[model samples]
Target: MVEPLPHVREIPPYVPGKPPPARPGLTSYKLSSNENPYPPLPGVLAAAEQAVASMNRYPDMGCALLYDALAAKLGVQVDQLAAGTGSVALIYHLLSAYCGPGDEVVHAWRSFEAYPIAVTAAGAAGVKVPVTADGRHDLDAMAAAITERTKVVLVCTPNNPTGPALTHAEVATFVAAVPAHVVVVVDEAYLEFVRMADPVDGLALVRDHANVVLLRTFSKAYGLAGLRVGYAVAAPEIAGALRAVALPFGVSSVAQAAAVASLAAEDELLARVDGLVAERARMVAGITAAGWWVPEPQGNFVWLGVGDRAAELAAAAGDVGLALRPFAGEGVRVSVGEAEATDRLLHLLGSLEPPS
Candidate 1:
């Protein structure tokens, strides 16, 4: 038997959400993964059905139609877009193409779980920059951590577990200070949920900085997580590099078709985004009023810094048939679902009264 590479041995496996157990007479609300509780829009469903006629053939290896459609929507050239199974896959491709054994990749700890995984899979050194006291990226410190050995750096805006996004000026400062040789990725997984006046415009930065790559997904606002279609907007050269490392026909024809159709229904999707924002506001308001510690999360989820009471709160929530994701040492990350589910979660929190 062949021994695994040293790098592979050192890598830790990813810990994903665990499904709540099926308890007798208890109905569970799954708000673990940050998914849209809403179903796919009618137009997207129709497009998927239409594309099912030709599953016999392989997907378009070039993803020409999908690239063209996204380019038109994003106002970028076709060559500047590269489609992936998901934005996370694009992240992996970027790391594989730009990073190696001796290189260093820096990202905020507890941001996106995939960042470290991708960096290590590429045989690169993973440098974790801690989040600020309030759970936002420390951009100045991240920039300071950079060195000649750093090949790439990731900025997860509206960060996953704790979600306060960086401002435009802050992003500009960090981007400008980084060395030209290091690739910078702005993982805007929850960009649409941001309603603040001056949230950083990642696409604009992509247009201005050739070294920067903007990653987005249909999984979030588009309600197409099952479709697994996401894309990266970057310079043509960088897009080409991603394509080179990406597995052939990485995105399915159906996924491409569905994404194109979803783009056409942008108005409807935006409306759903508004609904999530409203729901999130309600969730935060309810939790804060109830006197449990909750962060002002900009993402679709809410963070409760449970501290030592983390397990107890999670257990209490479970007893009431609400499924939440506990981030081990960190707090619990609860996704905002539909009205009914959100109401149920609020009711659960109120009833629990986890000790401070």
Candidate 2:
């Protein structure tokens, strides 16, 4: 067998959230992945269907329509935008463009799981700084971790699994502290769900700092995870570099149309986001009321830091026909899904003895 690179041998596999197991009588809910529980709106569905008619032909390689729509919505020049299969793919593109053997990418540990995978695949070293006790990024430590070998730094706001978001002041300070040569990627996959004051303004960061890049997606908030449409906003030079390294025709026609339609109907789509945010609030309130300390969740999910009992609680949820994502000895991440899921989760957590 042809030998693969030594780094590839050490890459940890990404464990995605599992589907809910069948229950004979009870309805099962999948609160494992932080996915939008709602189905796509009619207009978005129709757009995707229409695009399907052109399946025999290839999609617009440049993603012209999607770029126009995003430019109008984001007020950024089209030259600054680069779309890919998903934000995860964009991460790969960025790393591939800027990193090579012996280079370093700094990010918080327990952040979006793909960070390490993408970094390794790019032949770059990953420098992981641990999150604070509250599950928020230790921005200062992340800054301190940077060195001459560092090429990229990722900051996932309203971070996945553990759900605390960075404020504008926090991100701004961190950006100032980072060297001008390092790329600061602000991943905002759950931006629409954020209700916190002083949220990190990714656009402002991208505008003010040439080294800053913003990654956003339609997966979580727009219910287009299956279609895999994500984009990056950065300085024209960096965005061009990403586009240069992108896989041709990555964003499918159906996905592009659906994304454009979703953007056109932003207000209505965001109304659904509002409902999910309410459900998140209820979940947080119930968990805290039960005496369990949950990180202040700004995304469409909550984190249960049950320590060694993480797997136990996750198994308990499974037995009740609910699927939640658990990180072995760390904690369980429960998405704020349907109201029924929230009720079931609250009941399950409420019944258990709160973690000491």
Candidate 3:
């Protein structure tokens, strides 16, 4: 007999950014993953180095120091916060905690690629609501889609691939309308880049609403993607549920140290985020000026509806020494890199030929 669950065969594996080339030649820019172009700040590096010296010891399974630091910074109680390897792990833990066969998890189409994957892995059905033409989540549509089976609603603001962030009013309405039994997760991976007026204040929701959970990541603004540390702020009960589902010591010792030190260097990190915002604007302006259909990119990347020419354009960009993430048959995502990477992308765009 086949000694495994039959459903596992039908599951598609998650695909991250395309792997870098073997040799370090001038062929890849890795504008696919929305990682910060900056390196870990000085304080974070120092912390990591100190932790490295103690690698022989297992990390603090409780992540006590990191938890205290996060609580102080976010103005939450220690019981209200839980850390993970990254917010992605938190997402998975959330699903495992609350979703099972016959349960449903809701998310927007074309948002984070991992949402549906995590839902399916947990043996739950994924209900993907379509976004508006402007690419913002149609909260009402999502609310309408919910039924008794709905266990969680995942909302990503300044949504990935597409750019518009849901205003505070919009998110509040959605949260209010969703069924009381459903947990609403505001995945604010890119929240630090957003300077939008009336931004979605997830922390406030977590404090006031028992069903709300705020997932934030150090991978984005703090420039620690490689180390992998992120957290969720929720009601104490909900946080406990998440903790129950998470593996012990899931976060590395070095990751914890770096995350705590990074918190101390918030100003420096925000300055880098500010630079990225400026660079995002530049990427948008250049792409739009080229007459390509670029989305209103609010994140650290730009999405182009390049249609059938997407692969051709990506190839051209690669030939001229730029790497881009191609998706579907019509879309290409270009992460905002440093000045040199951005310059190369603009130059490559200028040299590309129209679809034949």
| Consecutive 10-residue window with the lowest summed lDDT within model 1 | 15-24
lDDT of 2 by residue, 42-86 (tens): 999999999999999999999999999999999999999999998
> Could you give me the TM-score of model 2 versus the true structure?
0.99
Best-fitting candidate, scored by lDDT: 2
Candidate 2 local Cα displacement, residue 100, angstroms? 0.9
Looking at candidate 2, the ten consecutive residues that score lowest on lDDT are 18-27
In the range 148-184, model 1's lDDT, one tens digit per residue, is 9999999999999887888888998899998887899
lDDT of each: 0.87, 0.94, 0.85
Off by over 4 Å in 2: none
Q: lDDT value for candidate 2?
A: 0.94
Candidate 3 positional error at 146, Å: 0.4
The better candidate by lDDT, 1 or 2, is 2
Candidate with maximal TM-score: 2
**What is candidate 3's lDDT per residue for 1-356, written digit by digit as tens?**
75655545545687687754333557456787898978777778999999999999999988999999988888889999889999999999999999998899999988888898888888898999987776778888898999999999999987987777888988988898887779999999989888777999998887667899999999989999999999999999889999998998789999999999999999989998999999988887876666555656667888776767777877777675677887767568888888878888887776665333
For each candidate in turn, the TM-score is 0.96, 0.99, 0.95
